[model samples]
Target chain A: MKILVCVKRVPDPETVIKLTPEGASIVTDNVKWVINPFDEIAIEEALRIKEKAAGTEVVLLSIGQKTAQEQLRTGLAMGADRAILVLTDQVVEPLAVARVIEKLVGTEKPELILMGKQAIDDDSNCAGQMVAELLGWPQATFASKVVLGGDQKGAQVTREVDGGLETLAIPLPAVVTADLRLNEPRYASLPGIMKARKKELKEIPLAELGVDVAPRTRIVKLETPPKRTGGRKVGSVQELVQVLHDEAKVI
Target chain B: MIEWSEQHELIRQTFRRFVEAEIKPNLRELEHGDTPPYAILRKLMATFGIDQVARARFERQIAREKEGEAGPGERAAGPEAADSAAMQLIPVIELCRYCPGMVTALGVSVGLTAAAIMSRGTLRQKERWALPLLTLETIGAWAITEPGSGSDAFGGMKSTARRDGDGGYVLNGSKTFITNGPYADTIVFICKLDEGNEPRERKVLTFVLDKDLPGLTRSRPMLKMGLHSSPTGELFLEDVRVGRERLLGETEDVPARAGAKQTFSQERAGVPAMALGIVSQCLELSVDYARTRVQFGRPIGEFQLIQLKLARMEVARMNLQNLIFRQIEMAGAGKRMTLAEASAAKLYAAQTAMDVALEAVQLFGGNGYMAEFQVEQLCRDAKVLQIYAGTDEIQVSQIARSLLRG
Candidate 1:
């Protein structure tokens, strides 16, 4: 069985993001990039499945500039068998990214597809659903646990919902989007990092793929969140209650 | 010219993540509590597959030796050598940021003790002892310093290995301020061979000994001013009998002095990386504190006096980083620093770390004096960088002597 895991190269969560002058985009200089945390969990799940099933191949797929190969290499280093990077310098939206993955699904024909519920950068949370809709396959989003059947034809996914978890049994050739609690991703071992250099990382220019790489929604303006003011210490419970009722207006 | 590459940065980020998640939370326990650092160190080795890498390198070297080829002076300088150097130093810098003591314990075990054996041990000895140390399965201590010997380690000679007339020897010595002394599973005991000669003229011999042998006593962990995360103690050996097999290289003819000197150079070279970590952390913390700490209706950072301190820290950090890069580049070029050069680097790095840490504490004001703040701990840890490896006085003399000889 072959599993395809989609990963995105996002700015490190710890990076101090700076916006461009026009507020159109972030200043990219010196920004350290890492695999999206949820995507890392997705890759971990795929690797776990590959471990249980013999002859299982774990393939990483990413769509971004050539530099995204770094993230792909990271996934490969985490024991993925191979990687395919759809190279494009253009800013592709969720629908466009879905179209590209849908095209790859036709040729690669993996039994299962795994992706993060949302990219931390955009937080769209719709790419996996769009891919599943385009391919007309079953999808389990926000997956916390995934257990494959003995025959490898289906999987049971436990999803983290608003209040609790909801389990779903998805058929073969399904798409599953991982959530935060799915699994803690393992660090890439040194040998794995060394071997990742040798693994096959096939890159296809997005132009050749002939997909409509266009942005559907425009980010009108970006604004930094308001800075939180320091809270004052109340002398007593009555003062705290008075402040909460008068100033905060929450009580 | 020697900036970290993209891959190197990624490795650093990943290792930093591990340290934050695994080591940071346990800092209080490791520093103040009685927890030994071996478990965490072992986990680090396993998480990064450091043990496997060491095992693979050891096997390759041993294979070459068995084929009658000379063991190519440990690390061969090449394309991978640069990466190898970065890989080794990155952890040192990262760990030193929070716990310099752990690096001290780790270096003594893997860098010094294992290195002593791998450099001179017979193929049988390497297979028997060095491999475990390299993998950190067995903790190791390279015992050279004694109660009487600090800078004059060999000259104050007290430990002796007397020939038992049965092709074995009886070892008697006590090593003080030994890293990992309390819990080392294996020890590389350095002592003078007493063939009934004058103590000053005795031959220095290196022997590998196990932990639980008869007459071998390991003292409990000793209390120290700082670097409490790394356990330091004393080792007492009285008539500890061992066969000739325990002798490194299975021969006494190999000059142990030169090997020990090489170890000293390696240890000294590592100091800059550790200093970089401490200084980098101190500078970062100081900057944060300066920006937010208000003193007279304005942030302390607005004051020129504070700016000078911050600027000095940045200078020291940059210099230390450059020294580390030079070490890496030298490794890539298959060149090793002379002992004098290594000493100079260590001397500067140690002083810079101490200065930066102290400045950071001052910037934090009364808060810095309190244990609640990180600067207080770093200030204490920074002092050891100078004392260990070689004291500042020793480094100065070594550098001056080389200059005068030239």
Candidate 2:
């Protein structure tokens, strides 16, 4: 099976990125770069399918700047065969990224495309569905567990919804997005890392892909969420009942 | 340059798979049987080359980042003496996350293998010993705890080492709960020397006693409640003799060369750290089960009471991790923590682990007590962290003494 596992680079969530005192862009002084947390599960699930299904070829694809290549390489180290760097220095809108990936969907002609449900930074859970729409392909979003088709035609995707789970079986040449319920990402070993560097990395430019990479919406301002305020304490059950009945105007 | 570059996560993954395949399936047999997965551990070492992983992370990574070139990704490591120890801790944490016994065996071996090279071994000794240590060809054990002096290892011990008529020292003593006692190829044992200093201050009597040494014998394994995969046993040295060269460091300057004499309570927090990791793992397992396991046609995790337990487990584990990780960094810096700090961390972490493990079992309901599920095993595993490394009461005593003195 030919597979393309889409990846992204994001700061480790545990990392402390200080904002300027005025609260503009983040303070980059001590921030450490890491693979997008959700994307790790994406890569892991792709690798899992590949391991189970024989004659599997996994191509890691990431649409971002050069730093994104590091995350792609990380996927490569975790057993992805090759990588494609959709190299762009600036932040592209989710739709543009989906379009760029859609462009490759024709040339690569992979049977399946695996990607994270959303980037933790933007938290925009749209790109996978948009890409699926662009390609006129079925999408199995928020997939926690996936089983490749026995006849090599499609896969059964188990996704976690708000209330419960939703299962779907899409035809071959489909897109799947991973949630945290998927497997944990494996670390790269010394030998695996060495081998990963040797894997073929085909860099695709935006102009060559015939796609517009500008964002439709601008991030007017970035700021931290306000701290939660302390709650008022009620003295007794009588006081609480009184407040609920009259002071709070609940009754 | 020391480059601690190894795929720690990969190793962790491999071990999890290994546990699922070899251990999880046979946990029942392992619990009932006498063998403690020594063979399996050797196989893991062979396949994973754990020593290489250790060498890469502990010895090389810190060395490289400390003295060699490092880009933005790598932070500057601390001084040479402590960096490796700190870096060395990652494997221990990862390994113990699944099973603590086999890793404990691996840990004791590391302490034994490195002591000679770090403290006193010649260039040739390093060349000869490094390969086996890396390959796990020969097992290693540290024999510091005598019958009398476990916590107060250097305080006062009756095990005496008298110089022979010709040369070497005749070692006469006993070491209990020595990890890898039955199969260790090399041993780092301490003995008391009849000396001129005060009786309370006999100083350190350290030696690198090879396993083949005559008069050395091993007793039966000490059966434990948990850590079923690690073989812990007693060691007997009835007039065991060693050559002058085998005595670790310059024999004449042995008093000052003692690692124990170097504010040991602070530097050696491996036992406590191991305890912390086990506790954290227990919390993780419990919280996971509580969330997934269901009751009343709903996920039990949805209930507020269960949510509180899960939240507390998270907070407790995080607090323990932060505390232990801080001390690990402190020890890595070769800084000495007061006895109270060490005792407090150990005491709190161990008890926290036991409490968490029990909560995990409670959260699991009937299955928590079953051997089939890991929660009960976690409960069994949690008890040793309190008793063996340093008893709960002993830690309390240590803390009280330090507090009283201050």
Top candidate by DockQ: 1
- Count of clashes in candidate 2: 8
For candidate 1, write residues A177-215 as lDDT tens digits. 999999999998877877787899999999998888778
Interface RMSD of every candidate? 1.4, 6.1
Candidate that would win on TM-score = 1
Give, for candidate 2 chain A, the lowest lDDT window spanning 10 residues.
A186-195
State every prediction's TM-score relative to the real structure: 0.92, 0.60
Report the C-alpha lDDT of model 1 over B170-198, residue by residue, as the tens digit.
99989999999999999999999999989
**Each candidate's DockQ score against the native complex?**
0.55, 0.04
Model 1 chain B lowest lDDT segment of ten = B1-10
**CAPRI tier of model 1:** medium
lDDT of 2 by residue, B1-406 (tens): 2232333333444455555555556666555546665676666654444556656544563454346555112434474434344445655665566566766677666554554444444334444553466456778777767777776766756666787867788888889888788778777777777665665666566777777789999876777788776777888989887787777663646553346433234333565556556666767777667667878988888988888778878887677767755754665565656667777877887787788778878888888788766777767776777776567788799889988887
List runs of model 1 lying over 4 Å from the truth: A14-32, A65-67, A87-91, A162-166, A200-208, A220-251, B72-75
Q: What is the DockQ of candidate 2?
A: 0.04
